[model samples]
Target: MDKQTMLSDEELVKNFIAGNVTCIDVLIDRHKAKVFSYIMMCVKQQELAEDIFQEAFIRVIKTLKKGRYSDSGKFSSWVMRIAHNLIIDHYRKQKNQVMVSNDNYEFDLFNSARFSDKSVEEKLVHDQILSEVGMLVKMLPDNQREVVEMRHYKGLSFKEIAEETNVSINTALGRMRYALMNLRRMMEERNLSLTLS
Candidate 1:
């Protein structure tokens, strides 16, 4: 349990891939509220949302365990996309005339901005993963890490990053690319899961 406590989101995912079902619980416990709220926005019924939430995660598990997981985008985004699609499938199957404006649901469902009260345990676990990810960021090369911090933490654009770093826009972009590459590689080496905030 101590060892598991140190694992990152990608690491937990690796555990899930390695056949530890409990890892899935870690994932659900982390994202359940955000995902559930996203579902409720669509279905507007707690029971239906819960059902789709389970179905979405089941599909996530199958995709990961079956060696079909691909890195098309952020992991949280991918899972939310899966859940969104299932919601669509559900409504289609029932032939229900659902008319909900999707403007609110266009972004990642697990967006940290959508906040609710959290339990003490969830808060601690979130802080732990966030802290570890912070350490990983510090582990990056000077050039790459600088860009990552500027972009993610400062919410700067490529131009802004370049301006702040006194580099050309292309250089800024390149640094970001390399930073992401190295970050992904580092997480893979440590078997870290990219935790959602």
Candidate 2:
């Protein structure tokens, strides 16, 4: 057991900031499994996950080198958050590319109807409602948007959202609550009707 391996995360971060570069190697080695697993789980593609994982660590290294790292003593959580954000960014970029390449870019919540047995009219109504909701979700504040997307789209429970986001369960719930409120207000302001009437 090397001494650096046994050091606390904060201690390792401090040492790294003080010019002991090997401490960062130790830190990365210690947390890589958890961080990489998280990225892989979100992305579900080995190549994409690997890229985001590397980018997350690169951002960490840059932040640390710039003396911008605040010692919160939760380095693992910080790294996980970075990886999560990177995964979100990757999806957003992919979506933008799709929209750009497709001349008739319609938002299809259900990409395929393989499992659904709905008539064309019903499907169109459902798709329109989902598209409106998606636009409203995008307009929400980042934290609120994250909570809503995780809970509804990703089907994660509040506890899971809290764990993944490094926030308290109550905080996650609060974000969801506020997100709903904001979405309702936005819908009313826009006179958006999500009904099939």
Candidate 3:
């Protein structure tokens, strides 16, 4: 292996911090496939995964440029964290998301997956609703948020979510249920309506 290739991720990060911008490129080139695979695993859509992959790198670049890149974790893990959040955020921003009523939201499992025939006006309104939903999801309690993100955004089965969370399947289901309930309450309390048509 070349000397640059032999450098560890932290070392590359340090080199980039020391003004060797190309080291960041090496870091990205080395980790792109694994990051893309993880994003694809979460989103189940190649195009969305690719967009998240690019966004993750853009975030990395911005952080490094601001000299805020921390060396405490594996660079791959750091990048994956960014990619994972972006996937979940994208999930919340998709069309036909959950809609809040008086104290709860109505859901259509199929709507979350299919694109609606939205016009410019409706699409803009829908985008605004998605942004609101994404914000509310970010406000959820940690465990509840994790479960909801994995089950809905990551597209994990309840069993898979349980295994990943190191919990029983029932616990995972309960967390997801509570998360949705919490999101519903949040939207109503904030007076955000999903029927923006």
Instruction: Put the candidates in TM-score order, highest first.
Output: 2, 3, 1
Candidate-wise lDDT, in order:
0.81, 0.88, 0.83
Residue 155 local lDDT, model 2: 56
TM-scores vs. true structure, each candidate: 0.45, 0.52, 0.49
RMSD from true fold, candidate 3: 13.3
Worst 10 residues of 1 by lDDT: 108-117
lDDT of 2 by residue, 1-197 (tens): 39999899998999999999999999999998789878867877778878998999999999999999887659999999889998889899897886423345687555566535788998899999999999999999999999998877655679999999999999999999999999999999999987777
Candidate 2 overall Cα lDDT vs. reference? Answer: 0.88
Residue-by-residue lDDT tens digits, candidate 1, 111-186: 4544545778778888888887899899999999999987766445789888888999999999889988887898
TM-score for candidate 3, please give it: 0.49
**Every candidate's CA RMSD:** 19.6, 12.3, 13.3
Clashing pairs in 1: 8-193, 9-193, 10-192, 10-193, 10-194, 11-191, 11-192, 11-193
